[model samples]
Target: MNLKDTAARAAILGTLHKAIGDELKAAKRELGEGLRAAKQETGTQKISVSLDEGQDIGTASLVQPKAEAAVTDAEKFTAWVIENFKSEVERKFVTSVKPGFQKKLLDQITAAGVAEWADPETGVIHDVPGVEMQGRAAYTRMTVPDAGKQAIAQAWQSGALAHVVLPELTAGGAE
Candidate 1:
């Protein structure tokens, strides 16, 4: 309203603006110093931690040597099976007719040993020496039971099952 009032308000506004600017500058300087100090401290400190102490540092991972060994062993076992028991394995895995039919046929053959045979179509009854039935041998597939699988898995997960020791080497030192 008046010249004096206007001049006084302008001076106060200018001072307030300068104070805010100075405060901002000080805050920025403090932040920069804090960051620099943190960086320097981190650089100076070498984080040497031994995981063997069983410390709960953070989220841990289960590294089972037995699991890896089991996989290797499984590969070996598969190879052995393929090499040594190829025919047996094939017979075991082969899918064919139902067992009931084969069993019934075998039972009939056994019962009709050295008996007379009658041809259904010709109606000719003839004495036979023996009934010889020849076919591929049937074998039931051998599967690892669920309980066995669970046991193997448990063995794989158990620390006592297998242990692999890695050689320790010094870092940033002469070999």
Candidate 2:
């Protein structure tokens, strides 16, 4: 090849390299911005729970909870976990895979019976209320305050807790 042709080819290659480099840098910047926006719009965190029978009852979660009312010190920090679990479970079954997969596992438990002290989705023993003799006893603590625990129980039993738990925590804010 002649010197002039070799030089011309080198210049064209250099120009192409610079153009590609600029595109790569711009794409990286756009990706960074998109990540930031996503972080702001929908932050995410992991949650774990164990409520199986003949096993320990525990939950682990990382959330930024506001106001002691949102969760008292006596309660487990996994309140957000319960909330999210309910939401994910009740999202509805679809023909496609993915979201419905979790629903399939959770839907094994169905609401049933009179007292309703169990979780319909996971069949776990969720919050149940203390029946204050219903007609005679002034105060009883078999489950929770008079009818307080029962309300939670009924909700879990009938899937009502899904609506209540999610909005309360999401509005109060979470990770």
**Candidate 2 residues 1-175, lDDT tens each?**
8999999998877765665556556554654455445445775232222222222233222233321111122123233333535443322352222345333322322222222235456767644222111222111112234355455565578765555344534442332
Distance (Å) between predicted and true CA of 119, model 2? Answer: 53
Q: Identify the leading candidate in terms of TM-score.
A: 2
Candidate 1 Cα lDDT to native = 0.40
lDDT of 1 at 7: 100
Clashing pairs in 2: 128-149, 129-149, 129-150, 130-144
The local lDDT score (0 to 100) that residue 5 gets in candidate 1 is: 98
Per-model TM values vs. the true structure: 0.22, 0.25
Where does model 2 exceed 4 Å of error?
Answer: 44-175
Worst 10 residues of 2 by lDDT: 132-141
Residue 28 in model 1: shift from native, Å? 1.0
Q: What is the lDDT of residue 73 in candidate 1?
A: 36
Worst 10 residues of 1 by lDDT: 62-71
